[model samples]
Target chain A: MEFDKGLIGGSTVLLILSLLEETDRYGYEIIRELESRSDRAFQLKEGTLYPILHKLENDGYVESYKAKGERGRDRKYYKITRNGKRQLAKEKEQWEKFSMSVNKVIGGELYATD
Target chain B: MPLTKVDKFLEDVLSHIKFPFVKDDISFELESHILEKIDYYMEQGYDSEKAEELSIRDMGDAKEIGILLNKQHNPFLGWLLKITNGMMIFFIILNIYFAGIPFISSLFSKNPINTIPKEDIVYKIDINDDKIKKIQITLNNGETFTETEFYEDLFLFAWEVDNEEQGRYFNNIKGYDSNNNVIFQDEY
Candidate 1:
């Protein structure tokens, strides 16, 4: 099923941070990995992904460095910072709480009592 | 390989990025992304021409990407430039206000100021109440002239007047005795 763009947009930072926590990835690698991991459901457009990456880099949550690719051209890679790790942990906690509450509502168990 | 299509694509994308210092790195990154996507397509057995076409198409609109990149590279510059322009306009208006008011007032105030000339004025007047001292007096506006060589009562002082007092001004006159008692007074 296709997800709402808003949902994907909100989760994008979290997903990017989580991916970078394991190993550094360049821009195209991140896009492909996200697609593969989500079974090709999270098809982030090139225009959308780059601006967020630049914003994350500018904000100090991620940093990038250039390394030559197999084709002898520069590939920019991004890695999460210590600050990004903390931000990820906080986001994870908030996501767990939010999802649990959302599940209760979806399951029809949550209702207004008063 | 001629990069004609890629060059056109990049030109379109970079058109949105206003700052020159930021252009090269952003252009490189995006171009590299396209080339990598092309390589992926080629690994799937597509020819170079088709791969380049597909990669550029997959990257979506250049104008859209340019807007995003432009925002990232030079944040707030457009707004700051506008604010700076507005302030310059305000300062120009203020300069005009400071420079124009005196000139406008001079243009509107047309009446020439009247002045008393030193040679045409009665520079000194000495009047005494002595019984035998003769005195000449003039009224600023009256046609009658009065000259007094008086004995008493007014002290019935004989007086003379003349036309030369036309533009001169006087508002008060008084007489006092040896005891400093006010004996006479008049005002016009």
Candidate 2:
């Protein structure tokens, strides 16, 4: 199922930070990883990703550098910073609380026991 | 060469960006993404044109993307940086012109005192007669000193000279009797 743009937009930074936390990834690699991991459910607009990435860089949440990609082409790779890791943890906690509240309101059984 | 569909798409997107420095990187990254997507589609047996079309479509609206990127690359910040860089270069050149030239020239030139030729001697003073009624001192550089009653008996003469060029002055002194006959002459 395709996710709503508004919903994806709100958590875009969180998703990117989580991805970078695993390892450094370039623009295309990040997009491909997000699509494959979500089983094609999260189809991010290719053009919009850069602005967010650049914003994250500007905010000191991530740092970028140029390196050779698998195709021998120089690519701009982004690495998560310590600040981004802290932000991710905070966002993850918020997400858990938010999803739990959402699930409770929807009468979902996943977090019903808690 | 005619612009390709990909190049046209890039131009459309980049045109909205106000910051020129980041445009090349943005263009390179976006083009690489599109090319990678096209490769993915071609692997699935799609023609090159069809793959390119799909890749461009997946990038979403070019104008919208450009506007978003422009927001991140704030033109004010770019201009500020450009102006600051230009000011820095201007200051460096000004400093070289004002400070560096004299220092470099000094290294190659002779000692400042030696640079003044002997012919440019300014002041030559000579005092031999203790009983003098009149005296006149003249310098080659168009400076003259005259004293009628400089002192009661000592004939004291005092004058200030530039210390940096002191070596060029006080070369000789000639004393004359009341009859204007040379009585004493000495070279310093």
Candidate 3:
């Protein structure tokens, strides 16, 4: 199912950072990995990814370098920095707490006994 | 080479970005991404033109992406930095013009006072009376200056002498006519 744009927007940075945590990835690689991991549910607009990547770079959370890809073509690869890893950890904790609280509210089991 | 649809799309996106330095890199990256997508689609049995069209379509609205990219670049910060750089250059030029060259020239001269040619030096005592047509003054430098050169040198001499020494400095001045007859002496 397609998610709301606003809903997906808040978590994109966390998702991107998590992907970059494993290894360096270029723009297309990031998008493909996101889609594959989410089972094609998160079809991010390819153009919008650049602004987020560029923003992450400007904030010093990520750094980019040009390197040859599998096709022997030069590609801009983004690598998460130390700061980005810390940020990802924080976001993950927050998401876990938030989602648990949300599940509790919507699960309707908290007041089921009463 | 003639412009392709992809080139037009890149141009449309890049035009909104005010910062020039980052545009080329952004264009190259985005073009590469689109080309890769087109290749992916062509492998899935789509024709070249169809794959190109689909690839561009999946990138989303060009104007929206451009505006978002512009926000990341922050044109305001870029312009502020540029303006500050320009102001710094202007101040450097102003300093060189007003102070640096004059200081350097002064260093090359042996005596600063003698830097002015002897003929350019003049001392003047103004006679406010309308009847006084010709007046001359002899300075400590043994230079005699007539009324004709008085106006130009008046400001130069006024600040050099204090009020207490004004009368003593003017004691050597004598007024005379075209025939060289002394009209007034030590009366000024």
Rank ordering of all candidates by TM-score, starting from the highest: 2, 3, 1
TM-scores for candidates 1 onward, in order: 0.59, 0.66, 0.63
Stretches > 4 Å off in candidate 2: A112-114, B1-3, B85-188
Worst 10 residues of 2 chain B by lDDT: B150-159
Residues B18-133, model 2: lDDT tens digits: 99999999999899888888989999999898999998999989999999999988999989989999999999999899898888866755443344555553443435456555
Candidate 3 docking: what grade? medium
lDDT of 3 by residue, B91-137 (tens): 99999999998898667544433555665444433456444556766
lDDT of each: 0.74, 0.80, 0.81
Considering every candidate listed, which one attains the maximal TM-score?
2
Candidate 1 regions exceeding 4 Å error are: A108-114, B75-188
Please state the CAPRI-style docking class of candidate 1: acceptable
Writing each residue's lDDT as its tens digit, candidate 1 over A1-114 gives: 568889898889999999999999888888899989999899877656888898888778999999986768878999999989998998888877777778777774453221
Cα lDDT of model 2 by residue, A1-114, tens digit = 998889899888889999999999998889999999999988988888998999999889999999987779888899999999999999988887777888889987677456
The two-chain DockQ for each candidate, comma-separated, is 0.44, 0.55, 0.61
Q: Chain A: TM-score in each candidate?
A: 0.89, 0.93, 0.92
Tell how far residue B140 is off in model 1, in angstroms.
99
Model 3: how large is the Cα RMSD against the reference?
Answer: 14.2
- For model 3, the stretches where C-alpha displacement exceeds 4 angstroms are A108-114, B1-3, B79-188
